[model samples]
Target chain A: MIARTCILFILPLLLAGNANAHHSYAAEFDRDAPMTIEGVVTEVWFKSPHVRYYLTVTDEDGNKVTWDTRGLTPVKLVRQGWMKDTIKVGDRIKIFGHVGRTNKTIMSILDVTLADGSVLTSRSVAYDIKN
Target chain B: MRLILVALLTFSFGVHAHADESEFSGMWMLDVKIPAEPLAGLLEIEMTDDGWIAWVEGGPAPVTIEGNHIEILVDARDRQGFLFQRKLVGILENGRIDGTLTSIDVVESAAEFGEDGSSWSAEAFVKEPPSQPVQDISELSGTWVPLRGVDFRKWTMALTPAAKEWHAGYDARMDEPQKRCISPGLYSAVTWSFPFEIVAANGKVVMLYEAFNLSRRVFTDGRDDPDFFPNSSMGYSTGQLINGEFVIETTLVTQTVRDFNGEPISENASMTERYRLSDDGQRLSVVLTLDDPDNYERAPIRRRVWTRQDDAVIYPFECDPDSFFRQLFNEGRMQEYIDRTPIRP
Candidate 1:
């Protein structure tokens, strides 16, 4: 049933990714320790593998730190009411997700919340076909 | 099959069948398919007097080829650079060649062999030389756009009934990552980069996909399949020439989702693609055949021509999945989309 549901609407990239075409998250991102960092939006990347948003947050000792949060694709985010400017540069935010599996890159965002009391989950969100 | 195996042994054993003896000594491309799939970037293989040489953009190594048999130090390093290490034991008589690759080293193999052997092989032949070296078109290189839906835009021809049925499910996709710009494997990225370059030489075709800048290599040498083949997103492709068209046969693709719509391609499908260039070499026609023993009974799936769009270049499509999904969930409408969507069988 799930297959049929998505067959007609399956995007090329989704179909391709579903094909498991290349590489692996386990091969690229750390899976053991999942970290959640709260910061301010510095930049946002809505592209493949996953979406990324830069959050500039201060550590517990008040030192400013930037955490790169990676989240789901825009197709999934559309259901969450995310637009091009959902989270812009200089916006206070909190991000949560696992660390990069390869190359020890910055923290990959899993989810984020804006200073305007808005929270968004980046993992996987269903869409409303009707609306 | 046994006779072919014997030929493989002869070739690998360094018996020196011919003065021009070389594992990959010709040009290759995708020819035909139960359902046609395109021959990626460029497929070329050249064996010089010194050694067998291969070139393609995007793969691990652009220049690599070794002696007749498995030369430990020579092969080991080349294997790592080649992205796959394989051995084919077969007989080589005159210009005739037949054999199978017996080992594959891609990480995807773990799932196919289960720590054992793989059941995959490739067989190819040399073809007449091209009238002239294929000229490179600089303007004709870059990423284009998704063809409406995967099944909507036709290339040079139309899809076979089976392929049509295979694509019929695209309408049900949930507009997930694609609308958001996720790397759609290596092939989808190809179409997106219309006018992309296809480097063909020797016995291989390298598809320089400009989307996420990923490249796919389709081998055309007369090498056989490996003993242990693995399941992957793109599966494994071995190429050859039929007439002037390059035919590539791809198999062992792992089941993958096309988009958030839950559209899926079964692992059992084997695809064949034919690439033909029109006179003057302006237009490139590619026909794809999708044959899935598990999904279809008869008739291969088909897709038509992909017109060469010149002015296409590499431009980044900013796709952020997190914010996109988050905003949707916040509206409390995420469940509604899922409920209305019908599930695939």
Candidate 2:
């Protein structure tokens, strides 16, 4: 019985690891810890691996720090009706998303608000959502 | 057809005196004893007073030839409508061809790459020749359905533990970009399409992909991969006719995974494919052998067959998704989704 129980337990862990081997955001973000920030879009560097947009957030002490926020590709953005000129540097934008694992400059945006007061949400539901 | 002929007549072209069609024309089969890696299917050469017209059963549309010039059209569908274009150029006996393939009536995406991004361009050449054209081979041209995914469907690629770990890291975020409708980069696109196109000319052969306007130039021109080459998704390939088969050997790939997909094709890998057309020009067969030091434990050769389909036209593949979420996030809406909703257990 103990052997069977251990087998059942270890097998699931092995399977889960295999499942996670393909690709996941787990290594970069913690699901348990969630945070949101509103900052200005300071710089945008659109290259491969992924496109990144830098944000400048000033602490209460008035010190300015830069954060690199990740975004989708130009092709994906274009389909979402985004033109090359959609977002620009120095734009006063508010972003909402998870703080990367490092808690440094990396953030994955879930939604955004443009300087003109327009809104676009990037949140998605689980592929199989109940309720 | 008349319009095409007129265009051919007006186009500036040249060829060697022995390069005439009579000696090279007529459908020919590959004699298998040539000792080439990947052999080509039945070979057909049709020469007219003006030019030549040829096709490998399952390859791209019949190539139109005029004097020394050759032309093929590549079209795909995108947000901008049915993207169609023509690539017109000339073929030479010494294995050199200069040409420009242009997008006909397509809208350029609003994106710009500083002052450098421009339209696509490339230079091509003939790679090899067979020992002798064989007769009585009629089972080699047509659309082949690969039972597996594009990359590893045939060859078994064994990844190192470190390589496997890197794959996990990439896949996690790779899909995030793919969900946004990005190009998925180049690697993902090639393997995305299960069955690719194969075309055979006199001493040369071509592989046209339905994936990302990606085409592999195999020179049956009797040369080897150069000592130095630019890094590219598809490695440099040198081809030639061993018997009557067109065999191509490729090496020096960039070794970058197209995306998070677990394919580990190495830069040092050498791949060879053989093509042959069956009689009647309705069947195509391809035999691929992959030799990679980094990814595979042992070399393996795989085979795939395609049937002729008159209606298989290459279409534009444009991958795009929405960007409003990122824009909104930029404007500060990150907390709304994460906090309002609970993570499903």
Candidate 3:
């Protein structure tokens, strides 16, 4: 019965930090650690293995800490309707995902909320077969 | 009765013998269903300038023929890569050679010798040069999307105590070779969510995986074993058509951990896959069997089903080690990761 389950529904299981395809994904990011940050995007490196963004988040201490936020690869993200210029370098956005286990700046992006209130998901399209 | 040992041939796809009953030379296709699963093999005995040289599965073997009595001694490595002697003394009658093959390994001599040894028969098969087949494998050959649901992506591996300890100490950041851009072997290659294309032609099946931009060749022609095969992650694979499905057996793979959980598949680990197509030719299903006697109590079976996606494009998914190292350096843990590694090559 477990074999018949829709494959992409296992993203939640990944959120649990159990079955991962990436190398040491659990070692890089904790399953239980969740963080939401709102910041101004400074750079976006669309590349293989992962697409990362350099965001300057103003902490509560009023200091600027540039966070290297990681997301899905350009291949998987493209299938989920994410484009290269979707989040511009100057655009302000809110990212909700699990924070890194050791590095607080790194994040395995779950979803991103753009300045115009449009939400882009980096999750697998397995949930919807049509997508 | 002194039963002299004979050849140890492991022939599935390719590697066939052109049996010549007269001189007892050339190739012989041996079928021994006794001590093992349909033990399909090949024996090549060729005459040199003066003496005769024999080989079993590309390894040197000994063959002696006199009157109707013949004895063969082949140093065959078992599935575990352990050396063993299998003796076959057969009487060549008509064109078929009938005999009894017995495992001379000391570990299981009692059980094998007590019984009438597994019956084995070999017939002279035509050894032709490898040629392209004129068969239709289009049902299994196409660009398809992998619907890999390893229990819907949850892993519950039954590991041995030795492997359990190895997994408990698994630090993926430093332990996994994929971090260095090496292929993670066939486990993740088939289990991942990327699209892969299967092309069958010219007596071979080529699997182009989009995950690591890796291409694996499965030879169906009766070619010799890859003597100089590279010791890569996926290893050497041979395929045969069983019934209407494609059966692939892979061994000599240079992989330790099997998956995300870091469960070990030891040096003796071998994987077998049977790919079948739905009646409607839309769905391609495969049952993967992993056997590592030292790592787990039992072999694990996983199913990967796919639907034909004609227009699916396979992009380059090469993992860059520089990018990974750069990311680690950005995280300020590059040194820590280096220190944690066990100096693996």
Candidate 4:
């Protein structure tokens, strides 16, 4: 109900990119291919390694696309001051992140702006790798 | 092929061995085969006041000689922090050292870094590289982050049959441990390319690892390792200042393969790490050795360096695994997860 936006957005310039030891940011995600997937949250799996959200988005051809978006670990997300119930299934959300190299629908979500305009960030795997 | 003639820099104090022993006592440039990538390093056998001593990278290894045969053991951990050992055995023939190096897995899992018997050859270490002035042990205390590219695992190991089997069917997209909130132990805890602060007391050395907020304490007091210790990802450790370098020996490590692509960690594994600072104290270099005899044919070494970042903040990395289970279920892997995870009675 309360809107708290960009709390984990340390610095826009600094958040440009980062890579963790687990999944190489540059090797796995394409920072050059930034996209926004706006749709209803079909599913949510908030856990370690990362938190994944499956969203049902309509593409250019009006085809339904389920974007598999990821964010920082749940530990990190919780630190950003959100509960496990922050975003639930069927919630309309907008996700900004880099797309996966092999799967266009797989993404490393950077920020999630909820329907109430509150934004939370999973900028843990941000990396400044090249195009 | 990388032949560096290491002149007897500190050989004056060591007594010369017999002709047979002399054949194996010299500097050697080692080139070996592994599954990951091609790797080479300097291996040396020289005499010391106590008798014979072996050197791999810049650390001393335990060596033994019989006739023209040489056997050496050096302990090291991988970039992923799996503790293992290297056993280098060679025989002198045709004026050269030719032998097969094997890795012994201390961890219980059959790691993929095993080689049944891989071929390895070495040339005499003739001339030595210009040595830099050594920094004092006190230089080790500070916040440090890995130098770019230093933390990546370069050298590889030969996998065992079981490890190869796991790796053959492995899928990173679905099975990476971090995907389940399993933060890597020392890999992310100590060498995460993030800043970690080392604070030492008279009795022990404590390291504050930033990535997972992992803290490690290395007891310096003269005490033997516990016969019965609890299993942990971060193994128990002890350390002491040795000749201006900070050396730490760790054991009682919990077997791990969750993060290392199922690279096996034997149940009885141990690790040895030596940390040194550059002459300017601005850089720190660490040589890590993994001798997984169960999985590999030779000792694989990892060398890393870190630079000071005193002002760097140790970030937060709390891992939670509930979502991983949820993902597995959502992806129709609940049965697989349940089957793979074996619980104790």
Give lDDT for model 3: 0.64
Per-prediction TM-score, please? 0.37, 0.38, 0.64, 0.55
Cα lDDT tens digits for candidate 4, B1-345? 123223353242233325566676677876666544334566766665556666565344667776667776554444323344566688777667788878765322213254437667778766432144344444578877655333324222445566545544544444454556454555335434455788876778888875656788898887877778786767788987666667787766655542343344554666677677776788877756555556443444555667776765555655666655654565677787666554200
Q: In model 1, which runs have C-alpha deviations exceeding 4 angstroms?
A: A1-131, B1-183, B186-195, B257-263, B298-300, B304-312, B315-320, B328-345
Of the pair 1 and 4, which is ahead by TM-score? 4
B267, model 4: CA deviation in Å?
A: 2.1
Query: How would you encode candidate 1's per-residue C-alpha lDDT over B1-345 as one tens digit per residue?
Result: 999999898776555433334544554331211111211222234544444443221011123323332110001111001122333333334433333333344333111112123222123433443443234322223332222111211111112355445444443223333433444553354333223446656666666654454567787676889888887656788877666666778887766433222234467767777665556555555556556545433323333444454444433334345554553464465786566445322
Least accurate 10 contiguous residues by lDDT in model 3 chain B: B106-115
Candidate scoring better on TM-score of 3 and 4: 3
Interface RMSD, one decimal, each candidate: 19.6, 24.4, 19.9, 22.2
Residue B246, candidate 4: alpha-carbon lDDT: 74
Write the number of the candidate with greater lDDT, choosing between 1 and 2.
2
Report how far residue A43 has shifted in candidate 1, in Å. 8.7
Model number with the top DockQ: 3
Model 4, C-alpha of B161: deviation from truth (Å): 4.0
Q: Give per-residue CA lDDT, model 3, range B42-103, as digits (tens).
A: 56666554345554433344566554556665433221112335677787777778998765
The 0-to-1 C-alpha lDDT of every candidate, in the order given, reads: 0.44, 0.44, 0.64, 0.59
RMSD of 3: 18.7
lDDT, residue A29, model 4: 60
Q: What is the lDDT of residue B254 in candidate 4?
A: 58
